[model samples]
Target: MSANHLEQLREAVVKMNVDEAEAIAKEAMSDGIAAMIMLKEAMIPAMEAVGELFGEGEYFLPEMLGAVDAYNKCFALLEPDLKQGEFEPKGTVMLGTVESDIHDIGKKILAALLQGNGFEVIDLGTNVPSETFVKKAEEHSPQVIGLSALLSTTMSEMKKVVELFEESGIRDRFRIIVGGAPVTQQFADSIGADGYGDEAQTGVELVSRFVAAP
Candidate 1:
């Protein structure tokens, strides 16, 4: 019965049914199903499936956004219990748009997806300077640092971030991934980024890989 309940919740999230997802989350809580179990077994997997659908071109931005909303609704219901349970995140990720670039729609989506996938995200917002990235990295020590830039002129700022980390001699401490409109695998390699993600889902998968790696 618990499995059935979790499965329904998963379906609701994956199908982008926000109200149904919230209702199922409430019911699951009332039924004494641990929030952590529901998150790990149902919600995370549902979001991952949503990512897969987006990658396969079966889901578009609107569908993916709806799925994220559903997941957020369910997560909101689970957060209190999760906090009380002392739920440790899968990992921590620091995200920001590069210095001088104010485009953050992609970054915001990436943050949401990362949160839904169980990573604790520290969003540094748009027009974040390289020094701020390094400073925050020292404070938070996230496993992954994601740099985003929507404009070609600001793409060079990602290189500055990598250079700053290298200059600080903490380059090896975190996996750095670069993305945005003008970012490419070649550019990432040239700028010494550990990985490149062309989209938000890809960015989440890259972070997951970095954290799961030995």
Candidate 2:
């Protein structure tokens, strides 16, 4: 419950100390600090800071992956408590890495942050085909669908997914967003995607806006 504990937890996450982060989360839970508080105050902010550093080129993929791992460790400890608490999810989000793109660090980070921000996330993992996205969207009816592609070669798969959704007459049923290392806002626009996230934090914000829209 003490502010110092929160600060330590935050530092542990930012420093990519996975074991220490999980230990601190457990300690906070034992002290009745609440899962949501640790999430909103320490863990989320730590990842946001990591995102900022990544944007500034002070951090690289390995650093970001480490931070995500640390965050995941802490989140795993708190997730059950978060689910049991009095919380209503803001919306449902379905995420996956587009076909041929086996990379999923960005998608994983986005999924964790979405869950922390009170969105129910269905992460479909890497190498997801266009038809699979449409199939899952139909099955889940999520508010937002996020496509990720780390390689420029796989970026076209995102457009294919969007086109298939449109062809299925369900494109308008959900907000479609795209992102990854090689994805740009212009690319998203050209693919008819509703939005583009340059990073994990931006992805969460974009999804938030889509779900909050009238």
Candidate 3:
């Protein structure tokens, strides 16, 4: 296949053409394009472009969701083709919402995107205690721990988890990232988090960078 097919695939995702993206993904796989290559060459770049569009105010929430939906369609088509354990993952990420914060959509989105980007993700679900995060981190020894909180009231719960790791002297073992509607860069810095994602897509990007960093 020509490079045009890859460009067409990227355009399909940028345009939020779900069916077309899936069809192209399937066709690309059949043409012997590796699933990871498809992800790195087409899907990720497409999402990056979509993120830029969103940042420019050219895309609204619905439009951003549409692009992500399109990316998900392609991901579903390519998922089974991904060989597990045959190659190393980008990184492992542990995710959870803070205790008393029952919201999960944001966490779920970040988990899925992280998985698509080749990270092994463990989603601890909503209302997760600081101890649970620490326990899981100890057990998994993940490269990153992602905290989510949709309520301002529960934001402090994220800080508690960070401090718990620090106090345990295991904080350097993994990078800490925080997100959700109530999360901010300032808040994350104040709590000693290594990174903050203002939104789901950007959060994935941040995690990717952290994992790839030395």
Candidate 4:
């Protein structure tokens, strides 16, 4: 497919026009486009644009939320129609906001970005306990586990969660990614996390690089 069609899909997603988004998605599929290609080339760019706009103050939370909703709706329509062997995920990611942190907007944005980029995300939602994160990781066996904590106080919870995984003997099984307002690369290093991102887009990029590495 030409880059123009991909750009059109991105624009539709930015506009939060569900009908237009669905039409473009169906068209892409009908044109024999690869699902992963569509996700990586079109949908992810669209959501990333929305995030950029939000960061630049050209868009607000409501618009960002709407765009994410539209993108997810389009994805739902296209997912079941994808050929069984044609959809190869970049990786599997389990994501959640750590215990005592009720702030979820950042976590939700990260989830959307990850899913839009072809990672199969298992979102565990807000205020997730450290034990629960370890338990879920054991059950799902994802390639990466993402923890978010917007509050400084809750950041310690990420360390405890890492400890839980270590105690479970599965610490080496998954790459540990930590993020949110209070999280820093130094903090991540101190806690023995594999990666740290200060923002949602950075998190997405970090995960992509981690999964793509040899």
Tens digit of per-residue lDDT, candidate 1, span 1-214: 8999899999999999999989988988899998778977898789778878988999999998898889877876776665452247899999999988876656766776677678898999999999999999999999999999978999999989999999999999999999987789999999989999987789989999999992
Tens digit per residue, CA lDDT, model 4, 98-212: 9988877567667766776778889999999998998898899888899999789999999999999899898988999999877999999999999999877888888888888
Each model's backbone clash number: 0, 0, 0, 0
Each model's lDDT: 0.87, 0.87, 0.84, 0.83
Worst 10 residues of 4 by lDDT: 78-87
**lDDT per residue, candidate 3, 1-214, as tens digits?**
7377789899999999988988888888888887767876787789778878988999888987898888877876776665344346788899999999887756766776677667888889999999999999999988888999978999999989999999999989999999987789999999999999987778888887888883
The TM-score values for the models, in the order shown, are 0.62, 0.67, 0.62, 0.64
Worst 10 residues of 2 by lDDT: 78-87
Rank ordering of all candidates by lDDT, starting from the highest: 1, 2, 3, 4
lDDT of 2: 0.87
- After the best TM-score superposition of candidate 2, give how far the Cα of residue 90 lies from its true spot, in angstroms: 2.5
Give the candidate number with the greatest lDDT. Answer: 1
Instruction: Give the per-residue lDDT digits (tens) of candidate 2, residues 4-87.
Output: 889999999989999888888888889989877787789878987888899999989999889988988887787677556225
TM-score of 2: 0.67
List RMSD in Å for every model shown.
6.7, 4.4, 6.0, 5.4
Q: Candidate 1 — which residues are off by over 4 angstroms?
A: 1-87
Report the lDDT of model 1 for residue 213: 98
Residue 77's lDDT in candidate 1 = 76
Better of 3 and 4 by lDDT: 3
